[model samples]
Target: MVFRTLFSVIVVFDIVSKQIIVIRDKLPYLKAIVQYKGELNKDYPDTYTWAKFLELGKSVEDSVVDNIIKEQKPGQCAVLIYTSGTTANPKGVMLSHDNLTWTTKALLDTIGSDKAEEVTKCTISYLPSTHISGMSSLAAG
Candidate 1:
């Protein structure tokens, strides 16, 4: 698909087993590694299990985070969401950093900051990470 090719690489993490079957069908080699060796793609930006991903995070230095913050601009793409494609095939839609921030800020402004702070906050995420409402909930919390 266009979106898949847009990136030089793509990694799907089956942290909660949600994506395992999809990976098995599309990239059997990755599934084989998981099944036979209990191993995952060890390269940067490749698929890995939740625990392995966390372990690999240890190797990332603080500079990486700093650089991310320093380099990121509001217009840059922050999330990719796919349409249900009721009329046609699914298409990838890029959501910018400003879009997400604006959504969260709007939610807070609508709810009123004082009332929001007084209420206990909880966030539930259903992944592919592009779920805007989920992102808004997390950001607001």
Candidate 2:
């Protein structure tokens, strides 16, 4: 019984740790529109606009990430999107795990892990995730 229990615990930890590693690779893409309770509750001022940011974040959490994670695929189709920001100009962009990996490698060539390691803790600072910069940042961790 003791052996079985220990084995089960190890299995569970291994599974969860694998998931965290996958997410860690793509951590840059997710930006929090609102302050988290755990991090913000200490030595932080609560402002009126913060409420709105939370609302927006909740909306996104419900619609985007929730829906995306619901699908489990060994390898998924690439998501192709267009970038149209404040400027009326729009351009097509395609993203997949392959693209993300290649881009990350290119980035690594320039800055290396110096900046990447320091950016462990990241938050989303912008609204309207329909832009290329936002999507690229989100896709390539």
Candidate 3:
């Protein structure tokens, strides 16, 4: 329900359903909360409810976080955005950490904001999460 509240679209599948329409349509993989009538399936593959997914964050060890941070580099890919197939088939565009950081800095400079801590900022993101602009906005924030 929390995920549904955050996202406009929710792809629900019945336990006995033969096909998931979104997946069948070749849409990008979406974060989902599967619905079932019987007992919760702990061993279900690639399935997680919003609460269950959030619980995973609580269980992460500090060392794991530290190791992830240590593994990151400026040139490493931060995100991959698939372009809308307006002209041709959709293609994934990889954005590096340096690319995102540079864009964020450029945005701040253009807005005459010296530091993020200098002022309060509020944003209401309406663009789809898959879009480059949307991803950039989230990264900049």
Candidate 4:
């Protein structure tokens, strides 16, 4: 399931100890662990907190970040948002970099081009990134 898989990835950070043990116990080979924050950080071995993550980003050299960004080809998977599993297991939606831009564009077009930019400036990205609309709002904001 999307939750199981994504949960494994997220468990390294915002975690539930018991659930992690159960999942890890059940599926030993499932490890979609951390990256970027600490690829091989000997100083801080574990995952970084939300604040530390932001700090790490700021610490990275601008040119290095820019080069990394430039290296990414178009249509690459940017965000893997999972759907709400009301009746069954949630579905993982693989959204591309271009898709994100298009979502923002579509949202703006619907709001009317004249006031789209104005409205977006005040837009708040509060919705959970579990839905396409939420992802769209994030892109818009």
Q: What is the C-alpha RMSD of each candidate to the true structure, in Å?
A: 6.4, 18.2, 9.0, 6.1
Instruction: State TM-scores per candidate.
Output: 0.63, 0.31, 0.58, 0.64
lDDT per residue, candidate 4, 24-131, as tens digits? 545545443343333333233334444555675787889998998898777887767656678887677788878887877898789876886688778765676546
Supply the TM-score for candidate 1: 0.63
Tell me the whole-model lDDT of each prediction, alpha carbons only.
0.59, 0.42, 0.56, 0.60
Native-referenced Cα lDDT, model 1: 0.59
Clashes of each: 0, 3, 0, 0
User: What ranking emerges by TM-score with the best candidate at the front?
Assistant: 4, 1, 3, 2
Candidate 1 lDDT over 43-129, as tens digits, reads: 323455555556756999999989998998989988766676799997887889899999888878887867766542653456434
Candidate 1 vs. truth: CA RMSD? 6.4
Which pairs of residues clash in candidate 1, taking residues 3 or more apart in a chain or in different chains? Answer: none
Off by over 4 Å in 4: 2-45, 121-127
Q: Candidate 3 residues 1-141, lDDT tens each?
A: 121222222323354223443243342434454443333445445455555555767989999999998999998877655576699976667788888788767766765566543432675568865555556566666
- Of 2 and 3, the candidate ahead on TM-score is 3
Candidate 4 residue 43 Cα shift, in angstroms, is 15
lDDT of 2 by residue, 1-141 (tens): 111111111111233334433443344433322332223322312221344454655656556786776763534435544454358655555566556556556654554557654452462638334444454445445
Ten-residue segment with the worst summed lDDT in candidate 2?
3-12
